[model samples]
Target: MSGGGPSRRVRADAERSTARILEAAEDVLAADPNAPLERIADAAGVARATVHRRFSSRTALLDALAAQLNERYVRALAETRVTTAPPLVALQRLTETVFNLKLSHRFAVQLDAAVTPEVLAGLDLLFARLRDAGVITALDPVWCRRVYLALLHEAHDLPADSPVLTALSAGSEVEARINLLVDTVIGALGGTDTTNGLLVRSVRTSASDDRT
Candidate 1:
């Protein structure tokens, strides 16, 4: 029984260490995909041996990061309640979630293994629903999806101190930028009617959460 306590603590520490390494890998690789494991270990504030113990090689580490991003993507969708929420609310939540996801894990999104086709199809279906609801004026849902993704990619690339980010006085600079990105996407999709009110309410809830 005494041994179990120490074993559990060891496991917990290992888990924490692994998580740190993965986060550091995301940050480092996002900047330089060819960065060495030593660089990641330095970023994680862990020894090279520790990173090697968890990930046998750089490729393995990358694979793990991609998997972690996929998990986060799935979790983000669930948190948005995409299937049950009103179409406009769901679109705003989805856009924000995806924008933040790409912003946080840039390298993973670039990888081919990150998001599976099935997940993307569901997102496309969401766009189609918006079209059916008269929220998106685009005749082609595929075109709307492409435009939305393009805008997200552009928004994620904006520097933290950019004027676009600076103009919004909201919960945080990033939050403000994301909200603006959502609005831009909505506008580009021609959701310029009552959907604007729905989007505002959705963003207000998100901003409130950030304040708390």
Candidate 2:
């Protein structure tokens, strides 16, 4: 007469194994976009049988990966210390974090194609928070999520040798690009001027300092 639940330790171990699998999958997929489950299992130091037992199929694995990514995004949004930051600043941070994660974890490629309805629901929850916080304008949450996904897809497609990606690998250029893009998008939504004076000024200052 047991309750319908696994023991706590068993549950914990299962969760831990799942996390490891997801981490390994992200690494393998980043290196090779079409990484197989056996390869992911090998990278995670687990058996192929175990990987199949856990994920059941490629689609299941991708669905789990999408859930994991959305969970990470939600956690980042919760922990971000943006109480006093302007809407644009918060949006910039959110976009940069998402872009970086997508670039680093190739699981993002599958997100757009195989994301489950549950994952979209989770994203809607996060988007509600962003909307409540005024981080984005009052647009349809579904549309906003689609737009975010599109931007991430574009960022993920950037070649590793591209100047933007190179700068992202090197320093704060990714953050700068996120800020520029966010400001531009927000300005368009708000019907305001989108020419960013601060960026132009910073570029000029850097050039002037270089000459000295």
Candidate 3:
């Protein structure tokens, strides 16, 4: 007798299709946050009914997206050596890794996902490690973490054709982005800036900036 191989194969295929839909949703929503579900299904090369079968509703779709992201976030934090790595190194690694996670999910392109308490608790634990390691002091560790994440989203959320985004797309882009972010972090922490560090210009904006 067969070990129900066909049923197992069909289940695996369904799982992969669901994953494909989620990934496409992320890319599509990143570009057009209000993109329709039909667009996402088109991007994934799946039928609209398949999207419905998998996600049921926008809320369900978003839930799946957030769940996938939570897994990635937990895995990322586990890999980052906040307590052992050098301050700047840890900062760079964590910022890049976390920002990449934001990019990797449909539900959090703006880093506005419905963060669960477990995730926030995990962040607090990481910040405590940084404080104990003397990587950061004076500044509240929670605030420091927020600043890093804000810097990441602000810089990366720019339009694809934005000059800042274009320049950052050149060689060693992640390194360049990390340098600017780390410099901002160091400055905010009242630490001395490194010699030969990137000198990012201060940005100024007001209500009018949003009207542009």
User: Per-prediction TM-score, please?
Assistant: 0.75, 0.63, 0.75
Give candidate 2 misplaced runs (Cα > 4 Å).
1-7, 80-86, 113-152, 155-171, 190-193, 196-212
Clashing pairs in 2: none
* Number of the candidate with higher TM-score, 1 or 2: 1
Q: Give the per-residue lDDT of model 1 (tens digit) for 1-212.
A: 35689889999999999999999988998889889999999999999999999999878987898888888877777776666666666777777678778778878899777777756766777788878878777777777778877887787778888877676655675566566676777788787743323465565676456436
Error of 2 at 199 (Å): 7.7
In candidate 1, residue 169 scores what lDDT?
A: 56
RMSD per candidate (Å) reads 4.2, 7.9, 9.2
Candidate 2 worst ten-residue window by lDDT: 80-89
lDDT of each: 0.77, 0.62, 0.65
Q: 167 in model 1: Cα distance from truth in Å?
A: 6.9
| Model 2 C-alpha lDDT per residue in residues 101-201, reported as the tens digit of each score | 66666655466643556556655555555576664565676876676666655655655566644433224556545544554454433323335434333
Model 3: per-residue lDDT, tens digit, 20-112?
Answer: 998899888888878989999999999999999998898788778877777777666666654454434545566677766655663564444
lDDT, model 2, position 207: 37
Higher-scoring candidate on lDDT, 1 or 3: 1
Candidate 1 global lDDT? 0.77
User: By the TM-score metric, which is better: model 2 or model 3?
Assistant: 3
